[model samples]
Target: MREPVRLEISVAGHAGHVFASREGDGGSVPASGPAVVLIHGIGVSHRYLRRLHRLLAGSVDTYSIDLPGFGATPRPANTLSIAAHARYILSAMEQLGVPEFVLVGHSMGTQFATEAALQAPPGRISNLVLMGPVVDPKRGTVAQQALALGRDCLLHESPSSNALVFTDYLRCGPVWYLKNLRLMMEYPMEQKITGVRAPVLVVRGANDPVADADWSRRLAGLAGRGQLQQVQGTGHVVQHNRALEVRDGILAFAGLGAAAGGEPLPGNPT
Candidate 1:
C-alpha cells in the first residue's frame, strides 16, 4: 500500500502560495535522504514531475514548487528572470528551514537551476541534476532557435492564443506566464553555467526532440560538476517514461546507493 500524500501550502513572497507536498508528516525526513528541490521545465507544472517524485520518495526529502508563473502558483509582480526564479526558490527553502539540497531541473528549469546553483550560498547546493538541459542559444540550429522563439513569442505576446496552444501552462494564466517566459529568454545562461560549483549530472533521453545528444554533451561540459547520461529509448521527458533510470542515476550520484558514503559516479547503471 502507498502512503497518502499530504499537502503543505505556504505563500511565497508576492508570488502567492506554493502547494508543496510529501508523504510523511513525521519528524524523520526519509531514507533516500537530503532535501531535494525539484524544478520543472517550460510549459509544464509540478504535475510533470509526479513520477520522478514518487520514485525518489524513499531516499530523499523532495519538494516541488510551481515556478512563479507555472503550475498553480500566481506570477510575481516583478519580471521573472533566471536570477529571480533562483532567488525565489532559495527564499522558499529558507522559509522551510531547508539548509541545503540537491537540485533536479528538467528542460528550461535546467537553465534556471544552473543560474541558481551559481548564486547559491557556498555549501547550500550539494549537487545539481539537469535533465534535457538547454543549449547555448547561439549554438542552437536555426530551426531550433526558431522553435524556441516561436514558443516564447506565443507565451509572451498572445495570452489567449498561448493559453490555447499550451493549455497546460495557461492554467496558471497569462499575465504571470508571459512575464516568466520573458525572463527565461533574457537570462544569460552560457556565462553562468560555468560558474556553478555543485556537481552536475547532465541527463537526457536518447530520443529527446529538443535537447539532443550533442546539446546535452555541450551543456554537460559547461556545468560545475558535469557528467552526461543518456536514457535509452526515452524522449525529452525521460523522467516520465524512465523514472527508474533517472532515480537510480540520481541516487548513485548523490551517494545514496549502497557503497561508500560519497563514492565517485559509475558509468551507465543499466
Candidate 2:
C-alpha cells in the first residue's frame, strides 16, 4: 500500500510559517550513511524526490522540503535569489541540527545547492548531487530566458504545476519573480562551479531534452571533484522513472554500498 503523505510546518528566515514535508524513515541520518536532503526543480516539491527517498530510505535518512512558496509554504517577502533559497534550506538544516550532509538538487534547485555549498565554510556540505541542472537558460531570446526563469521561480502557473516548488517566491508576487529572474540571469554559475569544495555528481536522463546528456557532462566537468551519471530510459525526473538507479548512484557517490535493485554509475570516471 502507498503511504499517506504527511505535512509539517516550520518557520523560515524572512518567510514566516514555511511548510516542509517528509515521507521516509523518520529524520535520522544513518551513523555510517550521510544525510541527504532533496531539493526539487522549479515547479515541484519534495514529491518530486519521493521515489528517490524510498529507494534510499533503507540505507540513509532523507529529507525533502518545499521551497518557500511552492508546496504548503506561504510566500516570503524577502528577496528570493538563489542565495536566499540556499539560506532558507540552511536555516531548516540548522533547526534540524544537522551539522553536515549531502545536497541533492534537481533542475533549478541545482543552482541553489551550488550557492549553498559556496556560502558555507569548506566541508560543511559533504557532497552535492545535481540532477538536470539548468546551467544555461535555453529559452531562445534573452528576454524569453528571463521570462522563463521568472515564471519557473515565481509565478504559479496551473494546478498541474507543482506550486510548492516556487511558492515562497510566488508569495512575493510578480515583482519578486521579475527580480529573481534578473538575478538568475546575472548569477555566474559556471564561474563559481570550480570553487565548490565538495565532490559533486551530475546526473541526467539519457533522454532529457531540457538538460541533455552533453550539458550534463559539462556540468560534471565544472566541479572540483565531479563526475557524471546517466539514468537510462528516463527524462528530467530521474528520481521518478529510474528511482533504483538514482538511489544506487547517490549511494555509491556517498561511499555507501549499492542499493538493492540497480548497478552503480558505470561510465569512465572524471
Candidate 3:
C-alpha cells in the first residue's frame, strides 16, 4: 500500500492535518467515484480510522482528518461546537479542491458529519456514513456515557482497540476530553439527522454499548434516505478491527457493488 500524503491545512484560523491516500498503480483513484473522507470520534484521532481508510482506499480515494484539538493538531483558543468542527472540515476540503465526496464519521464525528451534510452545497456530498454515532439521548448524561464507555472497553472492545483509544485519550488530556464530551452529550443527533439531504448509512458493532442497536436503527430511520447495518463481534471502535466489513458496507451503500464484492454479512454470535 502507498503511504498517505500528509497535509497541513488552515480553516477559519484553526490549523488541522489530513492524511490522504489513493489506490491504484500510481496512487490515483478512478475519476468515476466520489472521494471518501473519514472522521474519528472525540478524544481520538485519525489513527483509529486508519484501518478503515486503508481498506476503502483500494477502491476509492480516502482522506482521514485530525480535527483541531485532537491528534497532532493544536487546540484552538476557544472550544468549538459540533457545527464549528463541521465548518472546519468543509473549509479544509474546499481548500483541497474536493468538490464532492462521501463523508463518514464515527461516534462524536457523526455529529460533525451531520452538520457538514446540512451545510454543504447541493451535490457536494453524495453520501453520509455514521458508524457508532453518539449520545443516545437515553444515555445522554456525561456520567452515563462514561459508564457505557467503560463497559464497552471492559466487555466489548478488543485489547488492541482499548490501547488505541486510551492512548489517544491520554494524548487528548482530561480537560479537552471532558470539554468535548460535554458538547457531544448536548448535541441533538436525532433531530439533526432529519435535516441531512444525502443518503445516510448508520452502522454499528453488534455489541457497541456506546451506540446500541435500537438507537442506531432509530437514527437511520430519521434520515430521508437511510439504512442500518451491524457488524458482529465488534465494539464502539468497529472500523478499527472489522474494517473489511465496514468497507464492504460503505461500498454497497454507495452503489459500488463490484468493489463491495460478495462478502457475506457477519453474523451475531450467540
Per-model TM against the reference? 0.77, 0.75, 0.92
lDDT of each residue in 66-114, candidate 1, tens digit only: 7666666655566666767778777776776678888899877887788
Answer with 2 or 3, whichever has the higher lDDT. Answer: 3
Model 2: lowest-lDDT 10 consecutive positions: 16-25
Local error of candidate 3 at residue 124 (angstroms) = 0.8
lDDT scores in order? 0.66, 0.65, 0.86
What residue pairs clash in candidate 2, if any at all? 68-168, 69-167, 69-168, 70-163, 70-164, 70-165, 70-167, 71-164
TM-score of 1: 0.77
Q: By the lDDT metric, which is better: model 1 or model 3?
A: 3
Candidate 1 Cα errors over 4 Å, as ranges: 1-12, 16-33, 138-166, 173-178, 258-270
Q: TM-score-based ranking, best first?
A: 3, 1, 2
Q: Write the per-residue lDDT of candidate 3 for residues 22-61, one digit (tens) a residue.
A: 6564433334468889998999999888889888888888
lDDT, model 2 = 0.65
lDDT assessment of candidate 1: 0.66
